[model samples]
Target: MNSLSPDSKEKTQKRVWEYPVPIVKGDNPEQVDAYLTGTIDEPSYYNELCHVLGTAEEGHSVTLHINTPGGIVDTALMVAEAIENSKASVTANIYGTVASAGTVIALACDDLVTSRHVSFMIHNYSGGMQGKGHEMKARQKYTDAHLSSVFNYYYGGFLTEEEMERVIEGSDIWIGAEEVAKRWQDKLKKAEGSDNG
Candidate 1:
């Protein structure tokens, strides 16, 4: 049975599972309708999303409505993994500004829904550092290698190799909703096909 862990329970007061309409204190639900809005830096959003997924079952469906400027690569990755590992059929309804790590969560969904007016963006990760020159250099090298793997894995098909390279080189790639639709058409289709099968 799908249920929230004790720690997750203590962190969230909302219920994703409510059986039989007016849910009482002890009810179980199989589906989750969640949202990923605002900045991803907030731990509450992560907790809520995890609470929903914790109750997901094989035939369950989870809809995540996304609207964000994106934040924290680590948090985004954690959210992405949560969505990816869910047993439910996951769909992401992306709207508003979807940039940086926001795209990661969007792409992790099994299906996507967005308007032609939505704004989409992709760029390299950015951060600050301070230390000895050599130490900073070593850190930069390690960070680049690690993020390169992350970028390539997440955006391999969404962007051409040239575009991906440019992104790594600190270029910000922005596309309109129509362009995003055109670019991700094949990937979405493949995802749909796999879900159907």
Candidate 2:
């Protein structure tokens, strides 16, 4: 469950830096800092985040600095679900390449910010197992259905169904910062305007 099929093997993270990032609110208030680097292979990542989110005060925020190439889809989804259910706000800063399940996890945040050179990618969730011919075929169908469910959950309004299909059916897509800004700014601006009005 922690690894994907060989077709989607990502290079191991050569390095990871974990540090506290303080965000000031109301003159001065402490905030939680969490980093999601490399792969999401273990359940601990999700558990620790759930603990942090649960302990943080309401209206307080936790910043999740995401710099991963993605990992176990189910594990990432667990963290994503925790974020969705948490009372504290979550901001996911995509600082590097956020791909596959990583992208889905990022979308669970209340706010998303992309670094100048960050790239985002969304494609099919791929997993495979060894079995007899019929078993393999059934597994493929199950994987496909599960992937579609994930896609819909994370990107229901991001693009048209047809466009989503094209990307899922085609090769991996690299979405640069400009495209992210274009797609996300309108929603942000709309919210800002409403707040001001």
Top candidate when judged by lDDT against the true structure:
1
Clashes of each: 0, 0
Q: What is the lDDT of residue 87 in candidate 1?
A: 87
Sequence-dependent TM-score of model 1: 0.77
* lDDT tens digits by residue: candidate 2, 1-197: 78856555432221113312122223335467677877767766467667777667788888888888888988888888888888889998898798888888888888899899999987776665897999999988888888788787677665457868886796576789888767666646655787799
Per-residue accuracy of model 1 over 1-197 as CA lDDT, tens digit each: 88989988865545443311112123335556666666777555476576566567898888777777888888888878888888888887889888888899888887788875789899999879999999999999999999999998778777889999999999999988888777778766655687799
**Candidate 2 clashing pairs?**
none
Best by TM-score: 1
